[model samples]
Target: MTKRFMTTGLSRRSVLAAALGGIAVPALATRPATAALAVGTAESYVPIAVGAGGGPAGSDRVHVLKVGPDTAHTVLVLVPGMFGAANDFRLLARDLVAQVPGVQVWAFDRREESLADRTGFTTTDPAAYYLDGHYRSLDPATSAFAGHWGLARTLCDLRAVVLAAAGGGRRRVVLGGHSWGATTAMAYAAWDFDGSPGYDQLSALVLMDGGVRGAFAGNGEPVEDSPEQVRERLAAIDGGAVFDLSLSAVGLGSRAESTQIWYQLAGWYAHRDPDGPSVLQPRMPDALRPPVPVTNAALLGVLVDSGFGWPNDISVHSGHLAVSGDVRGWVDTGITPISRVATAYAGGPEPAVWEWYWPARLSVDLDVADAYTDTDLTRSLGLRLFHSGGLDVPLFVFQTSYAQGTIESAAREVVASSRIPYAAYETDNGMNHLDPLFAAPERNTLTTSLPSFITGLR
Candidate 1:
């Protein structure tokens, strides 16, 4: 079995040769290059050097899915949700090109350095960042970089990506995001970079299943986690050593089996024991196994076996949760199901264990002292955007009747206050947070309206 180890210090040739030579390799080897899809689109991953924000600064990759020719077209820059990979938008990006005709979609892959599995010190250091079931802080002050990963750096990185993608000059750019990505999008929209409006670079904003403020207390209304609550959710991710953050938060069903499947697909864990046959062997069908030992980069077969007793035919084995059903109850509910998947499939990806340590550090770094002094009306999109003077850009918010409360009221206020035309589309199609991006094009409710809404932009 091929062992995926997260180590540094060797020459690039040594590492690559070891990986090719079937020796111990870093987690980077597990990341498979995305194959170009058949949807008449070209996919290119561009790396942008991001200056330090909250931690050791490095380059972040942006995945561009360009449809038609490479000439100028409306660009929709999408940021993935927390810990989100750009590949999550693969299907949606291709579909948008077909539906909208000229618009190209670029999805950002945020900081992945922590995936090194070592303390954030010199790359050569071998101390595991995660020790004793808790992720240790690796911030410069704490461990390596000046700041850890903070929302400030996140916003800055996104801005840099926008400028770079625009080829320097301003163009019609619609900044969009999903879930936490939507939160970042809203934060980006509100930030006044260089003492000017942050939304200046954005022509419009498209938020899906996130950026809702009504759910928070200091965020204008009292939801569950009040501003006084001190966002422990992200912190919990930092302190907690187990990497079982709910994928259900992003609309995946909350089934332990499915979560295992998702993590396995990410190469977060090993499917095989180092000595014996794969621990996942008995659970998987013979047809699904690759000819060689199942490498982390192997195509993860969607769990389609009904014999496995999984409700949905989707590749993962989430219990009864439908991929498109109401999954909000599971978001932040904190009730993680016991993983029913076998032990081998349940191992943690070495890099993920280390990466979780810094996400909280980044959050803490972005948390400014005076931020609370500025209300959402003037400084941010708190639970909603009010009629602010500078928010003249077009905005489109898509929501389901069940999940529309987060931004509808605020979106209306912004539209009524400004001359900018906006649209809030709602449906009762039982879409969860993930449906808009991952659902099949025809099965997805929000995607159908995208063509008209985008083309309608003046």
Candidate 2:
């Protein structure tokens, strides 16, 4: 393996300090929790049951909160990022309803009630618990794999929630997600669930600060690096000592706790940059960018300590300036210029730094093989956007030039390659991978842009 970096005593202390200072970070709101009707208004936080049958192998009763005008024109379903609770979208929902006048918005809790209760229903560790409960044990002989929730299952669950919210009636439905949630939204859209009834309810999809095609292909095909090559790559970056320190400082908590902490920390790091333009710079390399430093610090503090200090390790490069300017031009005017958001979002020292530290600190083996596979998966799914054969509905794809990898590019490529009628746009104000949904005030420039995008769709 690789020589591990040991941030044992002093490093831990510094990290703890930095993490603590980064708490209470806020982002834009994407959903509403409660709303009042006009004079004779009737409002209720109705809990709609979602899932096939009483309970599948590892299924839980999903609950969605719907709030807005009773006679709404369309239903918008918002999905939160990893480690985020359904309530995270409340602000966004409310804002959309206010802007659209008669539109209903629904945000669902993806966590199974049992898992939610055990982990306090937060964003972290939901996947771990899902894996432990659903996919931990498998007779490889009979079962394909063992994990509580995979991309496919999550997509199915989302589809179920949408159908339940519609109450069997056909209506225009807009689907949106932030970060991993955005991935989930795209997966559902690209999924070829032909015989299933859920496919019919989708009207549009919104991908906010989410990576495009080749950036997230984890389990599809082999591209360049062989499995052996990936093993070698992992060997180069494995940091056992760092992981030991991290685990020791944090302690070996429940899978849920550990996962939750990881999510919070990742979020903290993503939003660490304050200057939007600077944050947008990294995307040029990866076609994606990171969020503001304040946001990243707050998220990290919540995960690491209750009082972490924000780090000042921001990098200044010409790549950022070029990408930031491109993104700004795209959003201010509905124009598709030759810009690179996915590259900027994905480009950055942080992800590379994480690659170096992650193997040692988290025991993750990210190799070229994994990267290639992820890219392949992204490309495969991207191809689905072309043929309206599966989902015959109006498709709205929102891309930001501040992202990295093949996310924005692949999305653009798919749109261009598909010859399908679609509405695609890129954000200009330099949003990072998670900024579209996690920006503060829920009413800032970032959040404001979403309503207009959705309204234009109507």
Candidate 3:
């Protein structure tokens, strides 16, 4: 297997070669020398138990994809967004570890990832399994317990991972998140752990294109849910809303088509047949599917590219899917590479990162908890938040170009309200919500800036 690098204490020729080669010249020029170590790829996959959790097997453990060495002095612990998994951070983690040597990046997978239908991965005909609906998925009712895996549990679970990384405070830990994962980071900062606060465990916070909404962190859109609405929302799982929508888009589902299958189909096909005619495009809506017959790579780019006008803020500028010639091609926007996106979205083996069992209860909990603020209704609903004011960790917020800017605005308000110090803030108008995570290493803000950010804090 190809070895992955992370910051460790060992000295290696490749590390020096990589640095001398100026792979990340801009970042390495300023980063600490000790932060440049790396370990083998085999040591990265880690899973920690959640004790006796209420959810299904998915909630039994939290998967962590570690880059660098455990002996590193600094750690970057990342949380995945909605329906995201540990593998989602692979490219970003690899990039970050390469630039800054001594920092270990612990990218996490939600308990929900355990529910993904990995069976499809064993098949060579992925399209038959994922696209042609030749598969069987777990019964929704069997996953009912997942509805109880709310924010409180998520935070508590994250706390366990942080404590492990901290090793009794020997390592300085930084928490980062993308999309709803950003919300998770902020919530972790504001979370109350027994008497100690969650921020006490973190040196800094990193947010990418996400913010907490509702009465607490909403930039302008405050949640106006009445107590009754909150109650109804709390009962969502009971009403049979247990999983997030899968396939091309939300609201379209057949029993055989799980989100895992869709992701694997798109990602795998794009990787294997990037220049071939799209297989999934014909099934997608007119707005999302390429107007003309396009290549698989182009098809994947359109799913998140701004050119397609994917209204849900999932849009990014990875360049147009079709570059030239008669058919579509990948036009790199000098941001994210389509190959990297394919790797992230594609699922192959047992530990591949793709979340299929997203608990509707967590979404409910985030909304009802209302930005980590404790209220009478929230408390009555069994949430343990209401501690946003206690968060005082340094903040580093990154907002993509095409977003509404609400995430940054909301983070700013939180920084001000909680008196959190602003370590850094930037807006890359060149990127989209997902671009921040998948940007090319040489030009990525995550790789170029985060190492120094974490090291400086230490």
- TM, every model: 0.58, 0.52, 0.82
Candidate number that wins on TM-score, 1 or 3: 3
Backbone clash count for every predicted candidate, in the order shown: 13, 90, 14
Whole-model Cα lDDT per candidate?
Answer: 0.44, 0.39, 0.65
Question: Candidate 2, overall lDDT?
Answer: 0.39
Model 1, residue 208: displacement in angstroms?
1.0
Over all chains combined, what TM-score does candidate 3 have?
Answer: 0.82
Candidate that would win on TM-score: 3
Give the higher-lDDT candidate: 1 or 2. 1
Model 1 lDDT per residue over 306-345, tens place:
1122221122212221112211001101011112121212
Ten contiguous residues minimizing lDDT sum, candidate 2: 312-321
lDDT of 3 by residue, 271-379 (tens): 8888888888677644334445677887777555544444334444565643345666666654666777887777545456456666666766666654557778667
Model 2 C-alpha lDDT per residue in residues 1-458, reported as the tens digit of each score: 11111122334334433323332223222444232213433334444444442323544555565757657767888775444445445544555666566578776555332232233113333334433453232122232121223344455667777776566674568887654456556556655455453345676777654433443332122233454653443344332121212322233233323433333224323334322323212321121122322232222222222112211111110111111322221111111111111222221211111111111211222212123123543333222222223444444444433333345555565455433356565553343333333233232344555566567664
User: Which of candidates 1 and 2 reaches a greater TM-score?
Assistant: 1
Q: Which candidate, 2 or 3, has the higher TM-score?
A: 3
lDDT of 1: 0.44
